[model samples]
Target: MNRFKAGEHEGVTWVRGIAGWSNFSIKVFLYLVDGVLIDTGPVKLSGILVPFLEQQKIETVLLTHYHEDHSGNAPYLAGREIPVYINAISLERCRVKTRLPWYRKVFWGNREAFSPYPLDEKLTTDSLTFKPVSTPGHVFDHRSFYLPDKGFFFTGDLFVTTHPQMVLNTESTPRMIEDLKTVLRYDFSTVFCGHAGIIHRGREVLQKKLDYLEDIQGKVLHLHNRGLSVSQITRKLFPGRLHLEYLSCREWSAEHMVRSLLTGKATAENPRPRT
Candidate 1:
């Protein structure tokens, strides 16, 4: 099943795309400012999202990452010759089809390959100028857009929650911590998140997330110094496994989180037991 909802804050218009069963569904958001659209929801919600976009006078599209959930409809816009911009590092990644796990395909659907422009310099629309900042952590090529004039930050999956329990095996908590620190140094009053929608007290919440991550990182390192294996550290820190771990066939797990902190690297697709 698919559902769509729209809202506005200040002058920015936002839309939510809900896909899958109500119990296990996930919500993704897209925002529009001036004539620019930030993120393209996912392929699963294209029926609703495409229609919604047809009604808006969109000019340019800004992608936060190459993840399907964020850039699923990029081809749709590119077919019409709209300028779609993504991080230069991820430009090549989007040039080919993206392979996904069964769970992701069921939730967000597969993303078709599309050519997108590189975001090297500042981007501007009618009235707003966007400063593209590299905030690699959630993904190697992730980015966040800062509207200096409005003091608004459009973070894709950077600040989903203050305390994230489970993350993809490819995620690196150490990098995420650095990304958080990087964004925290910037001045932003409102945050437009791809998953959590708009956050008015964005800076305060991001600071709390940073503090929590730092605390977790310290504890993980301390446990490692004590000769604890990744599994042991995960059990001590995160305790029991989350349902998403099984749902994603361990692609999303607390163990990966611990492993990333200990090794400061992303685990493999099929991460072997550390101990």
Candidate 2:
């Protein structure tokens, strides 16, 4: 069974849900602001989500990206003729069903294909307007919504945690650092994270995340300069084997960070160290 809780902030309602059985299961949140839904929860908990959405006067859905957890319920809304907006790249990726890892398929479920409306630079409702900020790193088409007037930022998977030990094979630490720096130039007081929920000190947390990644990159580079291999640096920096590495069958691991720092790529295969 799934579990969820809802919280309200002024005109916005934040729905936090656990996609599966455990409390430590993948947590995802959907935000509703002034009749606009920021993201839809994963398909695993559609029974709860579909009903909750039915009670809202949701005018449109502004997807942060095409990740399975974020776009899972988009097809449902589209069936109701509710326009679901997404970045062009994400729309193209979601137009066809993509096979996912067995773990992801079980935890977050697979996202069905859906036609997404092209997202604009700015989206407006009767009471609020949101500006889409391209903040890729977690994924190529990732975006964060900034409500300039309200000082709120809906960051999808951008700040899951300031110090994530394991990163997906598709994630780029360098690009993520750059995106964090870019978003910092904006003025936002609170961040509505995709999984962590609302954060009042969003800027501080983002800065910390930037600092942590840069620090790791610096360490990785220093070790590489000293003739250390990616494995050696991973052991020195991370110290112990992360359970996620084993769980993901090494698809995601601390070595990925070292590889990303040394080669500027975040793939499962490690590249030769810089000379």
Candidate 3:
């Protein structure tokens, strides 16, 4: 079943992809503003999106990252001769057609190989100009688009939830905190999150996310100094997160958070997971 919804906001059209059967199922959003389409939704939902794009005059496509859910339709758009802009690293990754995990393949589908044009620091349209901000931590090549004039921040996967129960094996909690802080310095009142939709109070939401990660990091460091193992600290910090760990097949767990805090490195034993 194809499930999706479109909403208009001050000339920006947001297309949201419904991932699963639940009403509150995780979703991915693609935004179109000023003839510029930001982030293409997953390939699985292209049946609806392709026609939707045909109705609009999209001059260019800008990707927040090369994550399948975000960049799956790049090849389709590029085939139309529409210039698709993504960071160099993300472009390279996409060119290689990186293999995704089973869960990602099932939910977002595979990203068809695409050749994306390199994005410059600034992307400008007739009515709007977006400044690409390097906000890593979610992924090394992740970026957030900021429209200073409108006070809008298109945060890719950065502020998914104020209180995230799990961090991917590749995520660095500390780096995420820094990136959150880095973006906070900008003047933005609204946040267009990749999964959570629009956040009216963008700064406040980002601050809350930063505080949560910093608090967790502090606790993990304190417990580590006390000679507590990662598992022990995880149990103390997140007691009820075991269900989430089980659901994600341990790909996302408190241990990932602990490992990020202790070493700032991803868990080497586990295969790299997507955000």
Which candidate wins on TM-score?
Answer: 1
lDDT of 1 by residue, 124-188 (tens): 77688999888878877789999999999999999999999888876889989999999988888
- Model 2 per-residue lDDT tens digits across residues 1-275: 44868889866799988875433477799999987899998888898888988888888999998778999999999889999999976666777665777777777778788899888679987777899999878777789999998999999989999998878876778888998998999998899999999999999999999999999988888889999998999999998886667766887788877788878766743222111
**Ten-residue region with minimum lDDT total, candidate 2:** 266-275
Query: On residues 120-194, what C-alpha lDDT tens digit does candidate 3 reach at each position?
Result: 679888778899998777777789999988999999999999988777776777778889999999988999999
* lDDT of all predictions: 0.88, 0.84, 0.83
- For lDDT, candidate 2 versus 3, the one ahead is 2
Candidate 2 residue 2 C-alpha distance from true site, Å: 7.8
Of the two candidates 1 and 2, the one with more favorable lDDT, higher being better, is 1
TM-scores for every predicted model:
0.94, 0.92, 0.92
Q: Name the lDDT value of residue 150 in candidate 1.
A: 93
Q: List the residue pairs that clash in candidate 3.
A: none
Candidate no. 2 TM-score: 0.92
| Candidate 2 lDDT for residue 186 | 96
The superposed Cα distance between candidate 2 and the true structure at residue 31, in angstroms, equals 0.3
